[model samples]
Target: MAYVLTGCVAVIGSNSLGLGPIAPEVARSLGSTVPTVMMAAAAFGLGTAASALFLARHIDRIGSRRMLQIALALLAAALVLSALSPMVSVLIVSQLIAGIASGIALPAIYSSAAAIAPSGRESRTIGVVLTGWTLSMVVGVALSAVLADFVHWRAVFAAIAILALAAIAMLSISKYREVLATESAPLPLEALQIKGIKPLLIACGAFMAAFYGIYGYLGDYLHHGLGQPVSANGLAALVYGLGFGAATLLDNVVDRLGARRVMPAAFLATGVVYVSMALFGGSFTMLLIAVFLWGLANHFGLNVLIMRLSAIDPARRGTIMGLNSAVTYLAGFVGTAAFAPLHTEFGFAVSTFVAAGLMVVAVLAAASRPTEAIVHTVQSERQLQ
Candidate 1:
């Protein structure tokens, strides 16, 4: 079950990240500029953000497994269209459709991970599933680039489509039953009214924005500033991915500790990572070390965030996770756009500090208790006394 979920996530992750390395080839093939061809990626992100906001509530009503299968079908169609795109506009439309599928698919995957976990091992299970991102980052993405070079850029999308088909088959045969909603589920926007939800969502937004803000310029810093080759950047990506996967080994520890108890430390450690990167980004070796640590700290933080969001309310998990993912990708765009000026006027160092400042906000958001949770706890304590 975990393997199937992991495979599903791997396909989604590849759908997002695999386009970057081969954008040039895609541009040349379609007779468009690289930046123009990359509009497809942007369209996909927007499609995801919009779907997450509007379509996420339907996941519970439709059932996670069923919704996932349907979304994968949509993704397969989109990827097929992408493989056959004769122009950049067609590619953009195709990716938009793919993004729409991802918005639904990711929340379903998260909800499924929670549903399939043993009693106390939900966090660990989700952590294990999150490692699929590492698979995409370190393996699928690189392989796509290689295939684009040796075979054709279109083959990359076709390969992912095949993987999506495989995931659908695996999910169909999986025997677990989800507690699906009937026609009378809560309203779509009501998930935000749940206790402790607002703060968690705020933290998620801050964390995502901060990470992307600095990371958007990381390659440029390495290449133009440090004079490193393209291969070194790839090595940096690999090291970061390995670090991310390595941190999942300690997910059991997190499960034991409880996500709420560990939230502050995770965000703080991530803040420190940003500061260290700002301080040590000059040398290639030091930068790689910092990047690795960044990934390690980031994985724990992200893991706890997702775990908390998933556990908020089982019935509302789909909506809650949709909100989480909505902020995440939207913040990705915001971070990149907001940091561009700083990265242009200054070097990457200044933007790193700005990113760290956002982490401070994340720490505060995570540490502050929602009014309802605290009030309920206090009232319960008084009654006990």
Candidate 2:
């Protein structure tokens, strides 16, 4: 299960983080504009949203292990196609396919992790699984930047394809297959009827929009807005990645502080960080610090959201988690598409302030209900489980 989760992170991380740093290079190579290349990120997010909304419910019928195998194969094929793409349109299509594969795989990975986790340690176990994403930001983004600078962006995609293939090989093991063989139930719409769920989803969507709004164009922002070189963009991304990686330490903190308390505070802090970057990003040192702080708070806030949702209905965990993934990437689609034009028209500061506004919405929604209510509900559900 750990191996499978790690592989999912590598696949998702490489596709997502790798593209941002190399968007300019890809635009140049394909004779496309930066905004057009940015659409590829939207395409990926939309594809993932489609799968999460439509295909995620079928994971139980299809079987998690079997579905994971198919998704990995598709992801590998998509990466290879991306590497060979001759135009922006083809690259967008490849990214869409990759997103579909990710949509299919991610819920299964999270479900498997939750199922196999020791009793009373489920959140911690899931946190460990999420660390794969953090690690990917470090390894995958850095490597993509280095390759795009020195070699070619195509090499980055090809290398990730190789990693996907390796993950597929690891999935073929009988032990891993057996671990993921549990049957999933059809997604229950009633799960959405759970208390605080609607507000939580809204908050999550807003948070995602805010995060991706800035993140999607981070490379371009550095290159054009700040006049930094690609290498510097890569290094700054590395710093943010490191902070994101370090945020997994908060798993213990979430347990101690409780997600309800931590989530709202984290959202507020992240919002402040975003605004700070918007105002003071001209200073390279300040930019690095703000970006790193943004990463740390962002990941911790996301983890808290997941922990809260998982508590709502452990029996329908896959579906709930699927909804989380769907809203997240769907927001990513909107943020990437909408914010690019904002940056083009107004500038980075205006676009980033817009993101900060979205974060304000997230903070409000997160604080709408008291933590004790959620804790009571989760505790009751656990007893029933």
Candidate 3:
């Protein structure tokens, strides 16, 4: 069951993060510019954000298992469509379809992790699940560049489609049920009213904006700007993913220290990394080293965000996490669109300046301390889990 959920996250992450490493190749294949090809990626982000906002609450009504099955089916179909797309417009539509599936699929994954988790072990369980990000970065993003270089860019999508299908089969025979909603489960927007949720969502948005703003052009900068082969980008992702996976070892520490206490430092580290990236991006070796640190810091940021949000409203976890994904993917769209001009004209460094600033916002948001009463309440709820 853990593997199935992990697989689902990997598949979704591939469709989202994997696009970055292969964007240059896809651009060439479709006779388009990198930014133009990225419009399809933006469309995917937009589609998922909208679907999660509107339909994520439904996961509370239906079992997570059932919701996942439906979503996997749609994702497989969308990947197949993407592999066969003849042009950017067609690719955009296919990706949007995949995004719609992901909107439901991701929240289901998170909700399931929390449901089956043993008390006091929830953070470790979630950290283990969050390793799916590393899997996507390594297997999805890293390998996609290699596959796109050696084979066709379309083959990458075809391969991810196969993984999605396998996950569906794994899910079908399992007697699975992980429903995180109760009678009081909030609607999508209502999840916002929960104490501290608004700030968390804002932090989520700013963090994602920073990542997407720089990452959307990372491959282009490495490939076109530096005259590196596509495989070089794969190597970068592999290094980053390793660092990301390694950070899971520290989740228990966060569990011990408390998420709020750790988040400010994590975001600050991320800001420093972004600053390093902006200053040293022209050096591929330095960039790879920087991204390794980038992954390390980001893993903590993502982990605690989930830890805080999930603890805040267990009854409405589906809705809360749905809003998390919605904000995250929407930020991806906004980041990509907002950074396009700077990336196109001035190269990657200029965009990193803004990305670094956004991290400051995340740092500020995370630093807002909870009242002692509220902290006591949060701690008590966590103990109950």
Q: What's the CA RMSD for each of the models? A: 1.5, 3.8, 3.5
| Model 1 C-alpha lDDT per residue in residues 145-170, reported as the tens digit of each score | 99999999999999999999999999
Q: Give the winner by TM-score.
A: 1
Question: Residue-wise lDDT of candidate 3 within 13-44, one digit each (tens)?
Answer: 98887776688889998898887787777778
Query: TM-score of the candidate numbered 1?
Result: 0.97
| Per-residue lDDT value at 191 in model 3 | 63
Candidate no. 2 TM-score: 0.84
Q: After superposition, how far is residue 297 of candidate 2 from its true place, in Å?
A: 0.5
lDDT tens readout by residue for model 2, 257-355: 777898899888888998898889888889999998987887788778877776765555567767878988888878877998998898888887888
TM-score of each: 0.97, 0.84, 0.86
Q: What TM-score does model 3 achieve against the real structure? A: 0.86
Clashing pairs in 3: none
lDDT of each: 0.89, 0.80, 0.84
Candidate 2: Cα lDDT at 260: 80
